[model samples]
Target: MASEDLKTIIENLQKKGKMAFLEKTTPEKIEAFEKENAVTLPEKYKAWLLYSDGGELFLPAGVQFYGIEHKPLLNVNCEDRPSDDYVVIGALASGDPILFKKNSEEVAIYNLEGGKIEEDEKYSDFDAFLIDLPSGILGIGE
Candidate 1:
């Protein structure tokens, strides 16, 4: 999705009472997380984290943004690092992974049910992913 589209999506979620990320995690924590992972977060994602450490957006298909302390990619454990070539970041309500490559910056959906990776170049980054995702799981929509 385009930048403006992303903004509109976020705003829509907010208007619908689905977006609620409050400022929580600290910069030091975020820094440690990055250092531990050995990856630099993109600017938009980094800024969102700084703005709202982490929170949930409810839409029945609720999406949870991993907080500095939550480890959204590492499955709630910073020790469980994902393999190279792909890094796990967030997940669908169904527990499927949302991953991306370092250089590409494109986010892909991984199906836990099929053990398959699906990449259609649909989402380019964190913001885009959030905005482009389906309204939500069953019963979680506008």
Candidate 2:
């Protein structure tokens, strides 16, 4: 889906009261975050951050996103995730994390506990990932 489509999706969700924004981060802040982490945030993911920073989704879909994080805790928070190469962008209620490669926009699901790869899915970019979020897990589905 295009960026406009994503906006419409978010707008539609907002009308249903399932959208919430964590905070908005400035370009300088996000750039600082990238410098601190020594990784470049994917363009699409960065746009998502500049759009809403991050927040939660419920009802039709459920995810607590770790966006650019409006505060100064982006580095610390990302480091707290399971792996260094996989940044936890969002997660399911089961605690499985939805990760994105540090240097790539590609997305994936890595089960931390069971150590099993349930989906083995990959998306070219963050937009594709969001537009095609799978259903039936942690309340998010097709």
lDDT of 2: 0.65
Give the true-structure RMSD of model 1. 4.5
**Model 1 ranges off by over 4 Å:** 1-9, 26-28, 70-83, 134-142
| Candidate 1: tens digits of C-alpha lDDT, residues 47-94 | 567666656676556666666665443432322224466666666677
Write down the RMSD of candidate 2 (Cα, Å). Answer: 3.7
lDDT of every predicted structure (CA atoms): 0.60, 0.65
Q: 62-132, model 2: which lDDT tens digit per residue?
A: 66667665432344345434467767677655666776777888877777676644554567787776655
Steric collisions counted per model: 3, 4
